[model samples]
Target: MTTETPAPRHETDVTSGPGAVGAAVAAAREAQPWWAGIGFAGRKKALDAWRVLILRRADELVDVIRAETGKTADDARLEVILVADHLRWAAAHAGKVLGRRRVPSGLLMFNQSATVEYRPLGVVGVIGPWNYPAFIPIGPVSAALAAGNTVVLKPSELTPAVGQWLADTLAEAVDGPRVLRVVTGSGETGAALCRAAVDKISFTGSSATGRRVMAACAENLTPVVIEGGGKDAMIVAADADLDAAADAAVWAAMSNAGQTCVGLERVYVVSEVADRFLRLVGDRAAALRTGDRPDADLGPIVLPRQLEIIKAHVRDAVARGARVVLGGTESFTPPYVAPIVLADVPEDSVALTEETFGPVLVVNRVTCVDEAVDQVNASAYGLGASVYTGDRSQGRRIAGRLRAGMVSVNAVIAFAGIPALPFGGVGDSGFGRVHGPDGLREFTRTQAVTSQRFRPLMQPNSFGRAPGTMQTLVRMMRALYGR
Candidate 1:
């Protein structure tokens, strides 16, 4: 979850029309053969070069991202840094992780030597979301490139310039049109890409849109990885650091105007510390200012349509008897929505049940850790959750019970910063992953091979079969089974 506030009302400058989608896929098709011809090591070298380039041009890239997405330049810098780290990690580890590895043959196949290798799945189609556009798109691109596949990426309509910038920067590292290309546009363009003859489709967006992408991919039987929406939660225990938990919760919930996927949308606190946690979190949230300034901790919503949705959620909660602890509704800030915090919100309210992708958080109080875990797991979305406790064992124990792809104990949304950790979710949150070892494998297919080392004296299926071979097989089965 990169940004959390509702988006501002602004016309998109570079959304791709339906006709342009066909042209982009047509271009990708033309570049397929050359991209596939590049062997694994060669592609790895190119990816390594791209990684270096991104790192060297990190500041400039961050500025572009911040300008496009309304995030602070410093926050954008962090995004670039993580993206560079992923590129470096994928390049360095691809050879070892995806390379051919020998496997032991069982006694029945003792004469054969076996091995497994991961190979690319031709051209890859990636449909990116507006939030963290560069980092999200780069994950699939890096892995696919490292495994020797061409890529055609379609970034969100909200931020096409950054998409163009990324494609232009990456083109310098790799030759040919098929290696890395950009197709900028709206949902139709994304749908067209999915329907094209691409071997795989990687999409990161809302769960509702993810379903549409998946349905389109089904037309070609193309495998897909959907990094969909998340309604993540944070658990505050009685023994938790009220100050730290409050700070983390406020920052996680309202940063980027609380538009992060794994950000703290809902917080569950023990009854003993509920008031203290609420006061602290409310104070911090109130102190935050959202605007188009460099000093502001929060930024305007990137998409204008998001504002209506944000308004609906807050209104629904208030109508259902939830108390607004802080800012609720502000007007005409050019896509900026002030941080809103709700307490005692009903469990079934839209703010609690569904994903409120704006800068609003619903706080609930639980009697115990079990109850907290239950509330956290009650939601259909389970991308991530955080637990704050001084006792490491208690934190782990509660974390173990929470059904989420990632968990942060005594921290908030730090999992994404660590390139080594797998970033994804289970159930409705989405399938597959986009970072760590899992991300690398998501773009590669496993190929297993076997070779005969020596001829057996008595082959199981041969011109001449010995009676003793059958006897030996029977004896082995009997010995193993002990029947």
Candidate 2:
């Protein structure tokens, strides 16, 4: 077994205590109304400006992300691209999705005009994860800001610098009260943020940690949006393009050192194509390289603790009669983990059941698409999945049967890039969404307004109503709906 030290702490890292966290929340609460008062158009203008600033400083942001997480430059660049896209989407769509809209008052209440609108929730607390720190936190932060709520972010201790960089850049883009704040520390700081009086909290991490966040928020009866862990699966139909499926499997399973919540951890391929698919996946995974060098395909594992989990899962699978096609426990070299592909891993093995959160893939054979779907749904997590087939309709059909929040047909992790689609999961994967229209509304609450435009023909609300008023109303109801 290879031993690895914990992530190195940086001198520039800021540790926020409870006092500091409380003060940040208080400041956000005080600044929310003014932020909201600017309205959607004004907010959009500011966000657009910020977007430009981010684009101009894209290289710098990428450098900071890569330095903190030890991910490849390409991966870090992808984060910057996604952050800008989500910011633009949230700023542009918030008004249309949350603005007040008129509703029909119905036959009996035609004199009253009714409207419904979503208003900001004042302040939101965001607890970010270490992996994909910038992209993940921006999902909640952009939506919260676009919805007019200031944000207080508590990034993972391992990657505090990335979170602070985001806050500093936003401040440079917009000259006013701090709409986004960063409070850095360990789990205790996150717990404190959850306990604070923020209007809502958006947390992204493991399911185990998410439960604790929920418990903490329960004390204040605060609402929360949890984006937890996922053992996302991919289905390979017999008719699927083996080359395409294999390529996607390799990329999804190994990218970002497989630290993605929506990454492919399990693959269920039909028996007819299992051997060919496995061979292709092994060949491709074997060619990938890992290091901090510019030519490297992937970087070292960001968290030291995760390295052990990856090793345990791989070893348990091998011990349980799984076939190691490419890499195994020997792939461990402290901090850096090479891609490992296992075949026929037992259903009960931790490799198949738990979130390894590393560059490891479990391939299992099934008799048909039905069996593949069953095995995919059998897991406790339901975050994301993909289906590959020659027939688009068949792929769609298989995707519908799988139990997950997002499904990509003939593609991998495509839903995350689209600004209009909501991103989230089910079961142990956690609840609530944070991406598109639903994401914008996640930071706001609905308010219904009704105004009396004119007096009704019958004063049904009055006790001294005229005789036969009830009969007239009954007749009208019968005419409208009792058909």
Task: Compute each candidate's TM-score over C-alphas.
Answer: 0.93, 0.98
Candidate 1 at 470: error in angstroms?
A: 3.3
Best by lDDT: 2
Model 2: runs farther than 4 Å from truth? 1-8
TM-score (C-alpha) between model 1 and the true structure: 0.93
Tens digits of per-residue lDDT for model 1 on 426-447?
8788999877778878888899
lDDT of each: 0.81, 0.90
Quote the positional error of residue 415 for candidate 1 in Å: 1.6
**Residue 146 C-alpha lDDT in model 1:** 75
User: Could you give candidate 2's per-residue lDDT for residues 34-127 as a string of tens digits?
Assistant: 9999999989999999999999999999988887888998999999999999999999999999999999998888999999999999999999
